[model samples]
Target: MDRAGERSPWPWSTVRRVLATGGVMIAIAGKLLAHDPSATITWNREVSRIVYERCASCHHPGGTSFSLMTYQDAQPRAAAIKASVLSRRMPPWGAVKGFGDFRDDKSLTQEQISLVTAWVEGGAPRGNNPNALPPAPKFGEPRREEIPTSGLAVSGDLTIDRPITVDGLWPEHVPPGASMQIVAAWQNGRVEPLLWLYEYNDSYRHPFRFRRAIEIPAGTTIRGVPRDAKIVLMTADDNSWFSRLRALFRKTG
Candidate 1:
């Protein structure tokens, strides 16, 4: 309304325009807050360690992929890294977490993924102190002699013929981008989860070592594996002296 107004020019259309403008300003303010530089998440403080420990194995100098060893190297690719982790595509562990515990699990925890998201959303700040950064990860040439040549491959459901101590599983022949869930169903009706392959890629295939050895008794049926998908049961010799000693202790005690 103007001071000399006979009839006010204010109308529903003008009101809507003003409201929309206000909304835009509010949205901009929210974005500013979300991208606040002072936010706790920073490359040096949190993300560096995570990347060094988890991603640097492949994303290091002279490694298979591009290096993210320094803040400068990682900052520009922050959004890409965030997207990869959010999609569960980086750290390339393949197995779904919590289904089976593994010693060499490389998948990020939900909290860790959230930290990365917040860091990226907060403008990927490098912390104040450069000295606070963890040491860059080191890599060694993969020893050819250490790689396993063979393992017991099970294609479909298989019943254990004898008690065997299993250390891990290897996805031997799962088609790229295919998924499979393997489980060991005991005769007494206890089902133990073995491994879950989600959108698996053979390029990153490796043995999924269990956190602890699983002693599967005879008659325990390995099930849920697809007919075309072959999973290798990584096992220790049941006749080994260590295994015999453990079995003797189990029987005596």
Candidate 2:
């Protein structure tokens, strides 16, 4: 999930713009290392290693967007790279940081980000140890799929039907042959489908943090639905999405 902090709105609409192996140990040098006033930060020693650990998964050939697998590919995209990371727009995990310890959270740390900034700002050097780069990340699971599912309107509202924002949903387990989507009913009485999760995997599951967090005002009616399963909404710990999730589980469990 992307961490919440003050950030100028990313102009990704303006057109701009990895996986870590080795058990998260050195997948990256992590701290961005104590800055060496004279140490050279080159592609081999630092930059490409960072790229492989955090970016290569989706950026590789035949993956999703264009490739960032090589320095050649990443060099030209330096500006866009800096924009996405600094804006916290890429590595799209929707949960806000400092709230939950999400597995595979690809959001870059401040130091890591600083490293990137330095690299891009200083000409993105390709230094020694190109071959020292670790194996790039790869995910065997399907990144996406379309599945038949019911919309939130499909299930009648049980509460007072007043406006309320959707933050999280849970089943504890979505067994084999089980999958679902968590749809959001907007505050304006309009229904817009939010998350459509298929082949439901908990490790990959994340709460939907609204870009513009919707607050359901009293008297505004809305609804939710459960498709082939029990679906519950979380409405606590406004500051921490998953913290609210844990509390929800405690109450129901």
- TM for every model, in the order presented, reads 0.75, 0.46
lDDT of 1 by residue, 17-64 (tens): 999999999999999987565667989888999998888988888887
Query: Could you tell me the C-alpha RMSD of candidate 2 in Å?
Result: 19.3
Q: How close is candidate 1 to the true structure, as a TM-score?
A: 0.75
lDDT leader: 1
Where model 2 places Cα greater than 4 Å from the true spot, the runs are 1-38, 137-142, 145-253
Instruction: Candidate 1: list runs displaced more than 4 Å.
Output: 1-38, 143-147, 238-253
The 0-to-1 C-alpha lDDT of every candidate, in the order given, reads 0.81, 0.54
- For 92-166, candidate 2 gives per-residue lDDT tens digits of 443345442334557788878888888888888887665756666765754763221321222223332444554
Candidate 2 lDDT for residue 49: 75
